[model samples]
Target: MSIAELQLPPSALHGKKRVLTSAFVGTTVEWYDFYLYGTAAALIFNTQFFPAGSDVAGTLGAFATFAVGFLARPAGGIIAGHLGDRIGRKSLLVVSLITMGAASTAIGLLPNYATIGVFAVIGLVLLRLLQGLACGAEWGGSALLSVEHAPSRLRGFFGSFTQVGSAAGMLLATGSFAVAQALTTDEQFQAFGWRLPFLASAVLVVVGIYIRLGVEDAPAFRKLKVENRIAKAPVWEVLRYHKRALLVTIGLRLAQPALFAILAIYLINYLAARRDDTTSGVTAVLIGSAVGLASGPLWGWASDKWGRRNIALVAIAGIGLFIWPFFWFLDNGPLALLPIAMLLGMNILHDAIYGPQAAWFAEQFPVHVRYTGVSLGCQIGTVLSGGLTPVIAASLLLAGNNTPWLICAYISGLAVLSFIAALAAKDPVGDRLRDSDAHDEFEVAP
Candidate 1:
């Protein structure tokens, strides 16, 4: 289908701004809930959930729990994608937020390792997995919900609201943790301050659900449903027909998860190892990371003006080159590093591309199978790129090369590769929303 042939509703109900707001708020709540777990895992879970061991061993154990959530993401994506395609985007979004909020709250209330022994660890892992699953399904629905409502020319910008939500969520999560830490003594923070953030998510979830329920489903999905065009097996169909898009999505996501993992999660560990600084240092870095969240929507807007490929290439290159230097500055001292760490931690360069990325990938698939295609592709990419980067970075540090320059270069290389992949990809902005038969007719034209 061609751009001229692309059909959209003329009704006021399909207004671009309204859809974007829905997507943005929903995604923000989901991500805020998701990132809170990462923050807690980095700071509190090692002591609270995992058994006593060497600091390294305990940290690894915490990270192991972190990884467990990622393992559940693909499954969540598959299930959420199927439900999204089959039922409706709006309902699934509500479920996603509720699921994420409940799991996070439960984690907050869970018994500590001392009280429950191995059971605490088991409970933490299960909750983390639930968070991952909820997020896995959450993004695709949110992204498509916006993109389907947008004009083709503005899809990139509109779809980017999803990333904006992500940035906001991360900022809020880190900032909340920082504020909570500041309000309480270190002993109090480890004992219960962290739980406050988790419990607070209950309020965000309710707000998100109310906002999402007010928004209508996308016209694209609605049209498909009207025609009974939704795929019976979206996962199998996406894998069979859109394999390249899936692979490309994975390759493109290579930089995002790796960079975020390093800066937000791994950096805390890195700093803790270097000086065993007070919570002030950790809070400083997290606040800096929150500052990084501002980049998402701005970058998304920029991508809409320029090309997605151009903006992504520039961001990737900037991140790759700048991260090495940022790490050098960070290594100088936390004082010297605070600003630099903030610069890098917030993913200033990376967010520009990342902000528009969900829409970029989601636009590649047709409406009928869009959720599955987007969720599966993103999860696969996230697992391969992000899920293991923290472990790798930790291992590298343990091997006596804890230099920022080295880790930056490694992450930057992944960014560079993903940028190259973006260069080779097709721009899906003006493409028609695919009908059911389009998948069967799909072919890779060399």
Candidate 2:
């Protein structure tokens, strides 16, 4: 409830800090692995791996891989969520980091269409799915680890790091690519430069494992284990007992991921389609992403102070209001840097809402089923909002109509729905974290 109340008496800060560090650093690396693939998709995958008869076909193929990750996310979430609840959050985080890093490393070494024929495409898809699965599990574990260890008053600020890591990872991914592009000739860069980022993941993975090993389980979870309150089937129980929370999680995710995909991944493609060269487009996005790295944490900090629901409501309203203007700046081309900066800033606003989301989501469930509920809710968000929105946006754009306002409206509308959901949610503030038996559910915190 208050900072002093949750301080762990200073004696426990040493252990708690270790967990927080692990969560933040591990998530940063995990995101780096995932975002590296996104950079490749936007810049080089079509030409290197999924070359088609034409540019459009090539672009479609690239996006197909990007979307593949989204589609596979739910399965990953379900499996990893169950494992996290049953075992420990730290173990799942380790597995996810290794899996994502290995998959990403493999992507760096993958033979292209030229070297391996169609297998290149197949191999890439498999690897992408692995990344997706790993990513799906990564969020729940990281958020819980941080929040569980955090002072209750600071849950929003610390919880924000998980998402902050996401933005930082994207920034790292994009920035690395941009640097690579600058150093190499177009010929050489396309020939091999893309692989550097993927290969670098191995180092990050090793570091994540090392850090996770040193961290202890959350105090809440430890108490649950001591009390014999672990759920029998967290996944099933979550579905059977907390259907309402699940639905709310799904709806909230739609706005966050869809808007994110539109602005971050799809915007580059959209810009490229509008202009012959996309160097400027990529640069604008890179700047925006760098800004996100900072904004995400700031948003998380705000959420902790003001309440997750209140912050989310404001952010959703802001993004809905800003969508048309953001696109208008892009339509006006590279000259609209100030407006574009503001557009990118709008996402930061979203991040403020999104930063505390994991803790907010997890707070709804008992410790035993927390992973399943949070993971399922997030994955559904990924599938519906994150995974599909880019494809949908692409289709909308291709229909000879470019009305960003409509897209903005759709994103804002979902946010409004989530706002209502938030308004109705039982707030968990001031409650000590509790464990649940298979049939034992916490009173939905309000």
Candidate 3:
């Protein structure tokens, strides 16, 4: 069959911009909710939500709640991916948005440890788990929504809309908190000011849901339905048939999330608690995230030229080599210049991996189980590297006598693994949208 046969019909592709917009807006809200918690875990949760303890122990405890979300990510991917693969991507996307918004709003309203004691921590953990689940489910659906609607030649570029949204959400999360912190005294900020960002998620969620409700499911999923090719158990099918691809996807995803955990989340706490600087990197993180927003599409465009793996390898290698130097600039800089280092290290270098990631993973699996495959692989990878990174970084910093060497080495090591995974994984750059075993199941009937 001609490759053109797999393409979205021209009329469907006519809505391409809307598809990208929908993907971008929905993720902005979802990630805003998710990232807000991570920012809070670093800045507020340790101080406000948990019981009194030493700095490291308290930070670790707060991060434990952060990790809860990562732990639950795989389950989110499994359930949402199954439903997305079977029913439609649009439905799962909407539900995940609502789930995330509700969780973020609840966390904003929850009493701190001072008010409710142990139950507050328990409430926080449960809500964090919901956020994690929603995040795990949201990425794959938004990615597929954009990539599946894109022209074959520009799939990488279009897939980047999701990453752009992710960056926007991070910017919003950091910037919002920065504003709140700037506006309040430290005492007042700790007392109640931190809740504003979480509560703000409710408004963003309403906008996101209204936007997403107007979107149609990706054409690929619709085609699957018409051909009756949807897998009855997509999660199982992905594990059974695509194990190697799944493993590669997980490894390929590790470096970026781990980098952010260190640069954005861990560093926030590390600087604030260890260096007595709470506001040092927040602006830099926001700036870096903004850079990521502009450059994500550029990397996606590069992937279209050079292939996804090629672009990813360059990024991974860049981050690995730059880690020590990056931290040196960050550690020694005056408060005014630290974000510049972050801007170069994070927005420019790390984004190389993130830019092409969604399309790269989507093309690795066929339509039938693509959502499950991509979501499960990413969630698994995140739980391993992204989720535990803050805890690990905190321990390493303390173990290494408050130096960045151990943390730099840790991130560099993950980058090496990422490079190896990219080298070993197949690059399906020119393949039709995907390859699915469901084709076999359909051959007898379609």
Cα lDDT for residue 182, model 2? 86
> How do the predictions measure up, each by TM-score?
0.88, 0.90, 0.92
Give the 10-residue window scoring lowest on summed lDDT in candidate 1. Answer: 437-446
Arrange candidates by TM-score, highest first: which order?
Answer: 3, 2, 1
Best-to-worst order by lDDT is: 3, 2, 1
Off by over 4 Å in 1: 1-14, 278-294, 333-337, 344-347, 401-406, 428-446
Task: Compare candidates 1 and 2 on lDDT and give the better one.
Answer: 2
Put down candidate 1 lDDT per residue, 300-326, tens digits, no spaces: 555655667777777777767766766
> Which tens-of-lDDT digit does each residue in 197-258 have in candidate 2?
88888988898899889987787787777777777788999899989888877767766777
Q: What is the C-alpha lDDT of each candidate?
A: 0.75, 0.75, 0.84
In lDDT terms, which candidate is top? 3
Q: Quick one: how many clashes does candidate 1 have? A: 1
lDDT of 1 at 92: 84
